[model samples]
Target: MAEQPTRAWYATLRHLWLDERDARRAVPPALAERLRERVAASERRHSGQLRICVEGGLPPSYLWRHLRWRVPMPKLVHQRALMLFSRLHVWDTEHNNGVLIYLLLAERRIELVADRAVARRVDAQAWSALVRDLGEALHHGRFEQGLLQAVDGVTELLAPHFRPADDGPRPNELPDEPVLR
Candidate 1:
C-alpha cells in the first residue's frame, strides 16, 4: 500500500475545533432525511447496500495517530470509513455488495468503501474520479447535491454487477438514513 500523505499542523487544530454540531449544520435534518430517501430509492434498483456517514471531525485517536506517526489524513480518513463499514455491519449483506460513502466535514474529504464482491468489479480509478467530482461539489457547499450524486454513482457502479431480477425489490440489509457524527 502507498503511504498516506501527512497533513500540516493547522489541519489538526481545525479538526479539533469541530464536533457533531458542525456535522449537523452541514447536513441538517431535512437534508439528511432527503438523503436517506435517496439511498432507499437507489437501493431498490440493485442488490447492494449503501451507508452514508458524515463525520464533523476526526476522533482523538485518529488525530493522535496522525500527529504522532505522521500518517496521511487521507489514509486516516479512509481507515475511519473502513472502521464504520464493519461497525455498521455494511459488510454483512447477503450479496457482499455493500458500500459506505463517508464524508469528513472537517477535512472536506470523501471516502468510499466497498465490500469484497463490489470491489472486485470496480477499479480504483473509477472510485477516485467519483470522489474527486463529489469533493468539488462539497467544497462549494453543495452537500446535498454532492451526496445525491455520490449515491447515484455508487448505484451506477453496482447496478451493472448486482442488479436485481424480475423488477422486485431487493432485501435492504442496512438502514438508509445518513449517519451524522
Candidate 2:
C-alpha cells in the first residue's frame, strides 16, 4: 500500500499554496504604512523610483507554479516578482533606475528587481546581500524594520548613479507608496 501524505506536508502546502485574494490580509496595516512611508522618503533622496511590494500569495498561473504533491502548481516568490516588475511598470522611468522590492509573505521570500539603468551600475551581489539581510529580518517577524533597511539600502546604492540635478526639482516619475497584492 502507498503511504499517504503526512499532516505536516499538508500544513506546509497550505502555507505556501494559498491563492485567495485575501492573501493580502497577512500583512498588517501598520507594517504596510511603515513601508509606504519609507519608500516615500527614499524616493525623495534619489532620482530612481523605489517601490516595495508585499504579496500574500501568487495567483494561479503557468508562470507561478511549483511541483508539489503530484502536481505542478504554486509559483516561487522570485518568479512572481519578475512578472510584477513589468506588470507594475517599474521600468517606466526616465533614467531606467526603478527598483522593485518584492516580498512573498507565505514563503517569506524576497526578490529585488532593478531596472537596467541601475542594474548596470550596481552588481547582482549587492542586491543579493540586501535581500538576504532583509530576509533574515522578515524571517524574525521584523516586517517594519526589514522594509526600512531595504529602502535605506536602495537609497544608498542609487544615490550615486541617480542623483537629482542641482538646478531644478525633478518630477517624481513614479508613485511613492508601496503596493500590496
Candidate 3:
C-alpha cells in the first residue's frame, strides 16, 4: 500500500478560491472588500485536517487462498496501481505486522489513514464497494457519503465511534457553480 497526497483535492480548492476572487473583483470597491473578507473568513474556517479510515479484509476461509493478497503484496503491484490509479503520493509502514497506508494531501490538508489488518479481514467485494461509493461521494463533493462509507467499512468487533466534526461548510452549502472569473 502507498500513501500520498491528493492533487485533485488541492486543485479543486485552488480553483474555487480563484473563482471567488474573480467574482469579487467586479463588485464595487467597498462591497468587494467585504466579499473578500467573507471569503477569507470562510477559507480560514474550512481549512483543517480531514481524516478518513477504511477497513479492509478477506473472508477467513479465503485466508489461505489470499495468502499472497496480504497488504504490501509486492513492490510491482504497488507501483503499478499507484502509477495508474493514484493521484497522490502514498507512504507505507508496518504496524502490528500489517501494512498501514498514510496519504496526506497537504495542500488540501486531507489525510487518509487506514490499517491493513482491518482491510485483510473484510471481503474484497465489500471493500471495493466502499471505495467506489466513497470515491463517487468525493468526486461529487459529498463528504457525508465518504463518512457513511467509512462507517460501513468497519467490522462489528473493531468498529470505532465517529462523531462528525463541525469544521467547514458542508458541500450543499457551497456554490454549485464556481463564481465566474
Candidate 4:
C-alpha cells in the first residue's frame, strides 16, 4: 500500500454533515440511469463486471475506527472502497475481472478497486491515473461526464483481455446501477 497522508483535523465533522441525500443529489435518478446504461454497454464488449458506488460520507463505524485506530483518511477511504468491492460481489465474476469505481462525496476522494485478474494485468500507476483524472472531474462537479469517461476508461483497460469473440450479450454478474449511499 502507498503511504497514506495524514487525516485532516476537520474530517470527522465533514463526514458527519454528509449523508445519503448528498449522494442522491450528486447522482440524481436520471444520471444514475445513464451510468447504468454506460456500464451495461461497456459490459457487452467484454467479460468484466463494473460497479460504481457514490457515497455521501463514511459510515459511523468507519469514522469510529479512524478515531480509535488513528487511520489516515486516505487509507480509511480506500478500506471502505475495498469493503464495498467485496460486499457488492464485484470480485465474484467468472473471469475475475470485476472493477469498482468508488467516490466519497464528502471528501471528493476516488478509489478504483479491480479484482486480481484485472489488477495483475493493469499497472498500479494506470489505476492511480484513472482515479486522479476522475478526481479532477468530480472536483469540478462534472459528475456525469466523469463517470461516463471512467466507465469508458475501465472498459478500454479490460477489453484487451476479456473481450468476447462475438457481440452476443455477456453474462452480467452484477447490477449495473450506480449504488448511491
Candidate 5:
C-alpha cells in the first residue's frame, strides 16, 4: 500500500474552490451533452455499458473532517468512483460489462472502473494507457476531445467481447449522461 500524503488545509481549500470555480469552463453544459451522446452511440456498438463522470473535487465534508484529507487523492477518488459505480447501478448489466470513467478535475486524475466481464478480457495496462491519454487531453483543456476519445476506446475494447445481439438489440443498461459532481 502507498503512504497517504497529508496536505495542508489551505491546499485542500484551494483545490476544492479553484476547481469548482472553473468547472463550467472545463466541461460546460454543451460539451457535457455531447459527451453523453458519444457514450450513447458507443454503447450501441457493444453490450457493455459506459458512463462518464466529472467531479469538481472531494466533498466539503472531507474538508470539515481533517483525517479524511489524510487519505491519499488516488484512494479518495477510487473509493468515490466505486461508490458511484454501485449507486449508479453500473454493475446491473446482464453480462457484468459495465464501465465508469471518473475524472476528478481538481486533481487532474482519471479513474476507470469496469465490471467483472470487462476485467476478464481487457488488460490493466491497456486501461492505464487509455486513462493516461485521456488525462493528457484534460491537462491540455481538451475536455470533450479527451472524453470522446476514451468513449471510443471503451467501445472498441468491449465490442469484441460483447457483440450486438442478432435477434434483438441489447438494452441500455445504464444512462449515457455525464454525472457532474
Candidate 6:
C-alpha cells in the first residue's frame, strides 16, 4: 500500500493547536523535519508571511456567540482592538518592502500584500539568508524565535516613538490655577 500524502504546514499547525490527538499522532517526524527545513529555506525567499491577529479572537467571537446564545463580555469582546488597529496602521509602513502574509485561521484564509520598494532593496541573497535562518530556527521547534527576529528587524527599520513619562508630575501634585481678571 502507498503512503498518504503529507498534510500542509498550516493544517498541521492547526491540528496541533486544536489538540487533535489523531492528527498529532499521524504527524511523522519526517514532516516535522521538513517543516524545519522549509523554515530554514525561507531565508532565501524574498517574501514572508507576517501573520497578525487578536489573540483572544481565536475560535472567533461570532462562533462563540452562536454557541453561547449571547454576546461575550466587553473585556473579552475587545481585548485586542488596539493591537489589531496598530497592526494595520503602525506596522504597515510604505518604506518597508516585502510581502505581507495575513493568515486568518477563523476565516480560513491567507492574504498576500506586497511592498515593491522593499522587495527591490532586499536582493535574493539577503532574502535567502533570512529563509535559511528561519528554517534552522523552525527545525529546532522555535517558531516564536523566528517571529521575534522578523519583528525585530521591522521594528529597527521603523523606529517608532513612545510617549515619555512626565518626571515632574504627580496627579495630586499640581499647583492651583490663579483666577483671571
Task: Enumerate clash totals for all models, in the order shown.
Answer: 1, 2, 15, 0, 0, 11
lDDT comparing candidate 1 with the true structure: 0.88
Summed over model 2, clashes come to: 2
State candidate 1's TM-score.
0.91
Q: Write down the lDDT of every candidate, Cα atoms only.
A: 0.88, 0.75, 0.32, 0.88, 0.81, 0.35
What are the per-residue Cα lDDT tens digits for candidate 1 across 1-181?
2333334566788898988899899888999999999999888888889999988899989988887888888899989999999999999999899999988988888899999999999998999988998999988978788999999999889888887757565557799998889
Q: Write one digit per residue (lDDT tens) for candidate 3, span 1-181.
A: 2221233334334433443233333233564344334433332332211222221221233232223333322332233333322322222212211111211111111222333443454455655565566556656756444533433343221233222236745332222111211
Over 1-181, each residue of candidate 4 has an lDDT whose tens digit, in order, gives: 2233234436777898999999999899999999999999999888899999999999888887777777778899999999999999998888889999999988889999999999899888888888888888878878888999999999989888887647566567899999999
What order do you get sorting by TM-score, best first?
Answer: 4, 1, 5, 2, 6, 3
Compute each candidate's TM-score over C-alphas.
0.91, 0.81, 0.28, 0.92, 0.87, 0.32
Ranking by lDDT: 4, 1, 5, 2, 6, 3
- Supply the global lDDT for candidate 4: 0.88
The TM-score of predicted model 3 comes to 0.28
As for candidate 2, its clashing pairs are 64-75, 65-74
Tens-digit lDDT string for candidate 5 (6-40): 35465477566855446666778898889888988
Could you tell me which residue pairs clash in candidate 1? 5-72
Model 2 earns a TM-score of: 0.81
lDDT of 3: 0.32
Expressed as tens digits, the lDDT of each residue in 123-173 for candidate 6 is 555445554564465467564465445444433322222111246422211
Between candidates 1 and 4, the TM-score winner: 4
Q: How far off is residue 119 in model 2, in Å?
A: 0.7
Instruction: Give me the runs in candidate 2 sitting further than 4 Å from their true place.
Output: 1-26, 62-64, 68-75
Stretches off by above 4 angstroms in model 1 are: 1-8, 165-170
